[model samples]
Target: MTTTVVIVGAGPTGLTLACGLARQGVAVRVLERAAAHATGSRGKTLNPRSLEILADLGLADGLAAVGRTHLPFRKYFDSAFVNETEPFAGARPSATTPYPASRWLQQPQLEQLLRERLADLGVTVELGAELVDVRQDAHGAEAVLADGRRIPAAYVVACDGGRSTVRKLLGIPFVGDGDPEPMMVCGDVEVEGLEPDAWHQWFGPQGAFMLCPFEGSTRWQLQASPETDAEGRTVPPSLESFQRLAARHTGREDLRLSDATWLSTWRINVRMAERYREGRVLLAGDCAHVHPTAGGLGMNTGIQDAWNLAWKLGYVVRGLAAPALLDTYQEERLPIAAWTLDVTSSGMAAVVKGIETPGIGVEAGGVGDFTGLSLGYGWSSLAGGGATDALKPGDRAPDAPCPGPDGAPGRLFEQFAGDHFTLLAFGPGARPALAGLPDHVRPVALDDPDGEARRAYGITGEALVLVRPDNHLALVAPATAPEQVRSYLEYLERLGA
Candidate 1:
């Protein structure tokens, strides 16, 4: 079978990219090696920026309904109560930023949601289809499956995982540190004698143990430093070891752990691929980079990766933009991946050392910017044009309350929730420039009668702000210079040509 794009792996990253491409009217096929969807409470926190991406896909309200937003950190030292603190105590949504706090939900739940969304787009994931090899030429690519089936596509993306078959097949080296010692053994389990209100943590000389109760469920995620035997080999993670660790750390033997749903040992593996693209094959998510699970950056970063690449892929496959547009995907996201690895590694080290300090481990190396809102691609080749006092090219496009074309109360995000670029025209002078925009660009004139939108963007006079499909600023130009807007779009079309 042939498709526009063939995505290997049906995890969050591949599914997200599939949904984004399908929404833009691009044909997509998602292949997963596993016979069915895997179950685990892996990577439970969705940062605010990821929330924004999901919201753009129209899954915000559904996620909010199932996700827990305000779980406090209940810390204990040697089973003695240390303190309780809320990480996002005063976080509230504002006109400029909605979904300001992280939401805690299982990664599998999110995968199911994405699968449903993909299904809504008339696409279904083909499970048990393992990719054995890939071949590509100047025109297109072909994926050779283990079952002797060959699927052809314009591009093939490897979202399989850190031990990616495609990456290895392409001979891309994964470079970084891999700590031999196990950092922690974690899994989902059924627990009793624990309150389901907060994330409980216990720190002792031996190690640390945490039990975070899943919202509206009996399962709790268990994380504990592994125990060693006489040979100094780490004891494999199991329900018995978990129960023993729970009793020893919390000093509560009655706290029983049973029905382990998933268990695995996690080491400090901080690595990134040498490059993200080769010929017609590309890497994304864990297939591209893997890092320490501190600050909940793993799954969220992968989701953002898919979001960043989706639009560019759609434009290229639809013949609306040059293939060079795909190069910006690496130019923008590779740097972010590098930064994630560095910070998450430091965060893991701090958590291991600062076990006694209240909320230190929970904060994970003082990662106050883990919300991912401050990350931008200002140095990117695609980012150019002027900047306002409060915003610049490659900055996140802030949301503000505005009126729609029908003069009804609405918000900027409402205008941006689609597979199209958004051009915000501030004041009447900028409105004319909105005309004759590309078909994929959606223009919204913000009169800012009450100055709400203008104030949010820090626009004193008239200006034109072009927002990328991923909600990042593309360009900022003066209202009088409509040619700058056209020039910027032309530049993107001819990029890497």
Candidate 2:
């Protein structure tokens, strides 16, 4: 039987993994419990770094089409306006950083776009086929569905959310506590008299309230502190609950909210999985880490987790890399998930205390920190030693205007496209392109006088930059690293073959 990858949960992460694997001709099956596509605005922002990754995956244009194009967030203190500015201001796109600004789209909208792209690759999610149980052995793994059908796969990834049955089945300890009390009641609602120009939030004595207009739709994401009696009892989460909270906090009888959907009493949960993998069954997305929604990092981080794992799995399945390569997924992602939990918790705590602006500095709980541009895996075993101060091994590979294979004006990221490792030789080098690279290793040569790529990459002269499939730098040498490339591939070959 052909080896197939079974992915549970059809959120952005699972679907993205399916898309990446499908493009590589790796057999994959996606199981979503929902009978139909989900609706409502859950995660609404896609940071700059995520846009770049999506652009490489061929979905950036579709996302830009549906997102609220770089809208600023407006803050208020009760009836008094505090300030209004671009949420990701100053992170503008340039020759090197092609997508520097963040974009906002409802989570459902983004998922649909991903599904469409996955469909183009001839893969469709199997809805209503929930994974009931999973068992793994030396050969592979088997997943039993609720419908009493069992399917075998080379590997299984549980992108199934916070209450993941896969996680529970693995007996992974999730150490975290809920806020006990609802910090706020949040949901999407159709409302009038509120402008959809910017994200609006109000802080006052009654409590904090937020009414951000959802772009591309006549709906607003309404968040408000629950009303409590003298006895400290709050009302149940409902449309009436939100209406009362909005009226009491905003004091704007003119503003009205109706047609509520996806209503829920918000609870704070910041937790990480004890382990990301067990034998052939792996955890991803909320199954691996659950962060407070403060930095908008939950979905973005999960998408990246899927991105990182997809390529690694593709390598192992293609027999180009060792199955042991799968271990690096946990080593690289576990720490990131923990750090994200801490940072986002800090952001949320600070916001509640009114100690910092919502979208300002990284430490001040702003876009600068959440963009993921600053994220790197310097500590990972995969990162090779380097001396460049500008672009270190494990750093995010920057994009720049450079010549394509045909010597025409092109972007460096275009070379990084597809399911492959990329070797970028900057300036004059002995080997402009490697002679005996695997079909997956794409190499490009030369540089520009404008010094765009050179400056961005910190390349003085002949330099070799080896970028991973997920666009993180694996090695950086002052000159060509032909031996290094061959050595790395050979290392994997010894284990895989």
Candidate 3:
């Protein structure tokens, strides 16, 4: 088989990349080693940033239908209720922060949603196909499947996992902290006597246990949240262990755990590949960086990796950008991944040290740091500094609930949902200057007396905000200075043409 890109692993990262590419009319093939879809609820929440990305991909409705906002967990100590706390008590929605809530979505549900979306775009996951070998040259790459099928592609991406076959095959050095000890066993199970409203957690001298209701399902996510190593590593989980853990921690014999739907144990992983690309092959998701699962950032970071890479790949494949443009994938995302690891590791360390104040909530997946809203490509060579306010060249394109062309009511995200370079002309004069922009460069003129967008993006006068296909700020130019917009587009033309 032949295609423009061959994606390894069908997790959120790979599926997300596939969808992004396919939507742009790029031929893509996805290979998964497993015979069936996953049952693991590994990544349970899509942080605000991830939610923003999904909204851009036109998945907000589907996610809103299936996913629910997380509620504060009511903590109980021993046999009695102690206090109710929230890891994100202070975090709330505002004009500046549109994605204020986290979507408590199960990983399996998220994947299935992506898969369905991919199917709508004429793509499907090729399961039960394991990569046995890979070979790459200057032109493209070839993969030898375990079942004796050979696939050729212009590029191959590994979203396999922490133990990625692609990363291992490339001999990339994974440099970071060792996996933390006394792992937490996680899975979904049904339990009795727990309120459906608030999540429940019990902390005691020995350890901690919790049962959080998994929205849209009968099961609740069960886990041990102890900071100390009160319990040692055991074998793979069974139903009996879950029952015992629940009975011992909550100190309530009435509550029972049964029918475990998923089971796995994992320690905090702090590692990043030295590089994400080699020859015609690349790595993404867990294959690229494995971090502490704190802040629900691992999967989100990996998904963003795919989000960042897909546009570059699409541009290159369609001869719209230079092959060197692909290099920016590592440049823009690796730092983000490194920063994510540091943040998550620090957060995990806090949990180990019990820094979550008794009455205050714990770190709700780094709710304070914008769950990636603060993440930007400020250090990338691609970011040019000519003008500055709050929204920098490398910052995320902020969303505002405003009107579209001809006073059509819409949000800022609607203009950026498709495959195009979004150009927001904040002034009327600037809109005329961008009137003849290329089809790929979409220009939207905003006339808001309230200056909702102007306040959010810090646009003083007529400003032109160029957003990359992945929705990151590409450039910010003065509306009076059409030369900057012309200059950047010329760069893309030169590289792509």
Candidate 4:
């Protein structure tokens, strides 16, 4: 079999990449080792930025319908709510963005929704097939399946995960060690005498315990340090141990454990590969980096990697962009992977080191930082200067609710839902400029998206934001001259075309 891009791993990252490419009318094939979709909610929270991307792919509603939604609060050791933040509160975007706040969702639901979208694009995900071997040359790449079938592709992405077969075959080192103090985590369980609606944790004398609701009925993921050495090394979880721990911490012994779905003993670690690409093969998702789930950032970051790379790869495969443009994947995303490793590792260390302060939230940034919406690529190709008064490139694109030209309130994200550039003309008479944009760019007058978009852009009357395909702001200015607009297009032409 032959394809444009052969993606390994049907996890969120690989699927999202295939979907993004397919949406752009690029041919892609996905290979996964698992026979079916992965069960058990591994990455349980979807950040606001991810929600925006999902919405653009028309998958957000499905995710929102089945995934979890939290009001965003943090409980301290003393049980006092230091600060309950509603970051998504009153989120009225201008024409530049779509979603306002984050959604706490289950990864499985997110994956299922993405799979559906990929199917709609006529892309098929080949599950139960593994990339047992791969060989690359100057012309293209060939991936060998375990069942003796051979597949050819113009390029390949190794989203196979942390212990990736592709990364290993390429002799790339993961280059980091697991956390010195490992936290034993388990999710397969039936709990008794516990609140199922709210996420809870207890910081006690022995150790700490974090219990959060999973998607299914009567299930919650539990994480803690083993009470006894016997349980610590090769722990077989039991109801008694759960009840005893709950009693010791929450002063309640009514908790019961049953029907363990899945449990794993693993430690948090800050690790990244030396490079994301080796010749014609590239690494993404956990294959590129792995961090502790302390911040719920692992899967989200990997999905983001796919989102960032897919469009560029699509352009390259379709002959719209130079193959060298694929190099930007590592240039832009490796820094983010490194930063996530550091941020998540630090957050995990806080839990491990027992940094429980009364009325104090988790570390410097708290849960909001881990949500991944605040990811900044100030050094990216799309970014402008380091900072701006309002919107800037590399920042999460701002969104607003506006009546479309059709007079129904539409989201700013609705404009760039597919493979198109967004020219956000915020000035008075900017519509003419938008109407005149080239075929490669999609123009939407913020004035048309909604009344709030003007305010968000700080445009009392005039300004504009150029949003990239990934929905990150590209450029913000008061008024763009025709020459300036042409110049920006020329930049895209040079970089991508």
lDDT of 4 by residue, 1-497 (tens): 24888899999999889888888877789898988888776777776667777777788668757745544434436333344444345665335544445566567777888888998989778888977899989999999999999988889899998889999999998988875755664554677776666566555445666676765556677666655655455454555565566566565545566776656666666679999998789999999999877667777788889989988888778766667778888988999988887777777666556535443333333433665666877787756532246656777766666567767767776777887778877656666676667776887765444357665555565665677788777666546454556666566557744
- Model 2 alpha-carbon drift over 4 Å, by segment: 1-3, 229-231, 355-364, 478-481, 495-497
lDDT of 4 at 477: 56
lDDT per residue (tens digit) for residues 112-134 in model 2: 98899999987889999888899
RMSD of each: 1.2, 2.3, 2.6, 3.6
Best candidate (score: TM-score)? 1
Per-model lDDT: 0.89, 0.81, 0.80, 0.72
| TM-score of every model versus the real structure | 0.98, 0.95, 0.94, 0.88
CA lDDT for candidate 3: 0.80
The residue pairs that clash in candidate 1, if any, are none
What number of clashing residue pairs does each candidate have, in the order they appear? 0, 0, 1, 11
Candidate with better lDDT, 2 vs 3: 2
User: Higher TM-score: candidate 2 or 3?
Assistant: 2
lDDT of 1 by residue, 1-497 (tens): 34989999999999999999999888899999999899989889999999999999878877977869898988888888888888888999998889888999888889989999999998999999999999999999999999999999999999999999999999999999898888899999999888889999887677789999888788899999997889988899999889889988889978888999789898889999999999888899999999988899989999999999999999898887889988888999999999999888888888888786644546766554799999889998889789998989999888899897778999999999987889899989989988888888998999678898888888999999999889899899999998987888788778776
The top-ranked prediction according to lDDT is: 1
By the TM-score metric, which is better: model 2 or model 4? 2
So what's the TM-score on candidate 2? 0.95
The residue pairs in collision within model 3 are 295-365
